[model samples]
Target: MSTPMWKRVIARILEALLAIVFLAPLVWVIICSFSPQAGSAQSDGWGINNYLTLFNYQAGLPTYLFNSIVVSLIAVVFSVVVCTLAGYSFSRFEYPGRNLGFMVTLSILMVPYASLLIPMMVWFKDIGLNDTLLGVGLVITLFQLPMSTFIMRNAFNAVPKDMEEAAMVDGCNSFQALVKILMPVVKPSMVTVGLLAFLEAWNNFMIPLYLSSSAKSTLPLAMVNMRQQTMGVIDYGATEAGVVILLIPCAILFLVLQKYYVKGFMAGAVKG
Candidate 1:
């Protein structure tokens, strides 16, 4: 079922074309971030000033970066721990209404986050979780749990039942078997879940804005305020630089965890 030579050539051409189309904007942004306003780079003087200005700003890019990292890490930790436990239970244990319970959790994934905002805000206020980083992190964690749990469940479920049975034969209890054997098999899922949770939390805007007060703002909200306060002349240069800054950690994270991400997906998808 190999493609004809002409078809293979066409496919390759289409792929190259699509790659350029997709990468064009990213290349343009990188160019602009280094481009100067009036010289040669302006007169051959386009340097990393925009990136420098991003650091030069009052709040300092580092502070915003730290905030994003802290909030995302908190949310990611909650997501991994809670979702792993819930996913393991769903995948490995039997109990009354287990299917119904899973269905309920998965149901939340279908609903958009926008739909939950108002009710969540009210709940946050009632709990005194409002106007705080913890509140925003918790909100992001809540939204992330259902989908990540589902992913982890599928991942753990894909572990062959024989492995668990073998462990039991060797005197391993259920908890011991999970920790000693199954958890390693599902490590890829853990990386994937962690990356996804971190990205979602890092990029979240509405929850942070709604939950934070003037004294505290996550990077996304801060970016918005920075734009507004600058009036019409939004520093596309600086903004682009900031966006590059925002993207740095996400890039590093994916690069570091991409192998696990791929492994987890393949394991889940190919489960027999």
Candidate 2:
């Protein structure tokens, strides 16, 4: 049965309220970014110039931004590839220890990442992976894998086996069927997984903080630098601008992929 009219009205009102509650902080940061002297009594420093000033230091934002971009993009590619393969195996193949392997992978999510920091640092150093972007990206990909695999497995399970069989009848092998036929069917889930992987890698601070050296710091580290520019004083204006810059890519990605994200991904996830 349909929801009652009064309940529907109340739900819509609550939804609108929740949207405002979430947007409030972002709106404040945007406003404060343009503020000339944020956290000051004068309030005289409010304008669009903070954005322009972000790239004023050539070595600062640009280099860090490049590091972040490279790390995130690499992590996305690796995560999506591994997750797709793992998910396909879980969905299509029956093997001994399969369920146990999937369960072990999922168990990674149960442990606190913070708790693993010390061990991760020691392990990376021992393996000569410390102070490298590749190491950072690799660790990020591992962190994202369990969720990505879960999503992809559900997506693949939701797909009809008949389609792959039909493609095989057309002389396509399993890999070809996956690449040419089945992949299109699950592209939405792929986008969701890639977007999530990118966002997580992009926003990751502690990983980079522990693993990175001074020469190869990421954008989030740059934001931290902005926060503590001087010993006693912080530049709130630049920091807010950094926050905006950091947030823009995530917002734009969701806006662009919102259709696939909201529709296909969830429906597939709802399947076994």
Candidate 3:
């Protein structure tokens, strides 16, 4: 280990190269998003005209952004709450058909997501959820459940049984112990699950496509609609602007919670 100076240097160089490779496209998109292009609403040399165009399209940027945020937040809240309880149940309680139930839940992952949308669309319509933001969010939450449940289950399992026993010995009830003790211990996994759910719902195109109308479209659907010109030509500039808008929240969220996300996976891997 003391004689690895050259190896470290090589590793650093390789890391730099890989970073460039990954970041190059993002940088290019950001630059191109500002560059002047034909059919841009603003004829100024270089500015935010592309963004302006996107902002003014269809229901407008604010509406689409609001829809996306609403859907993503709905998915996050539902996934975290349901998965937390489920994970706790699976880890702490012994029940009939527990393993079989878990397996059945995970088996949903094997089905193609798109294939179920049409059938679910009909169900959603009958239930008064079709063409609604809540409907799309629920769909995203359903798809996210399996993996989120797995993560939370492993996180709960990785905790010590003695912790729960200690809490009970101190007179805390099961719910109180879970809320006051075990939940805090597994916060990273919760954050990871929430973040994953947010990203999935934020960028989902197909769910909204099948279950929603134009008024309920999220950012992804808006972006696709923005791409069409009067003559069927694609508006690349406006499209890139949409990419920048979409990338910002995801990038910031990931950067802020990256440590927790990695720790969450590590916690699950350590014991499971």
Q: By TM-score, who's the top model here?
A: 3
- For candidate 3, the TM-score is 0.97
RMSD of each: 2.9, 2.5, 1.2
Identify the runs in model 1 with alpha carbons over 4 angstroms from their true place: 1-4, 38-45, 56-58, 229-231, 270-272
On TM-score, who's better, 2 or 3? 3
Better-scoring candidate (lDDT), 1 or 3: 3
Lowest summed lDDT across 10 adjacent residues in model 1 is found at 36-45
Q: Rate the local accuracy (lDDT) of all candidates.
A: 0.80, 0.84, 0.92
Candidate 3 colliding pairs: none
Order of candidates by TM-score, top first? 3, 2, 1
Instruction: Estimate TM-scores for all models.
Output: 0.88, 0.90, 0.97
Q: Which regions of candidate 3 fall more than 4 Å away from where they truly are?
A: 42-44
Instruction: For residue 142, give model 1's deviation from the true position in Å.
Output: 1.3
Q: How accurate is candidate 1 locally (lDDT)?
A: 0.80
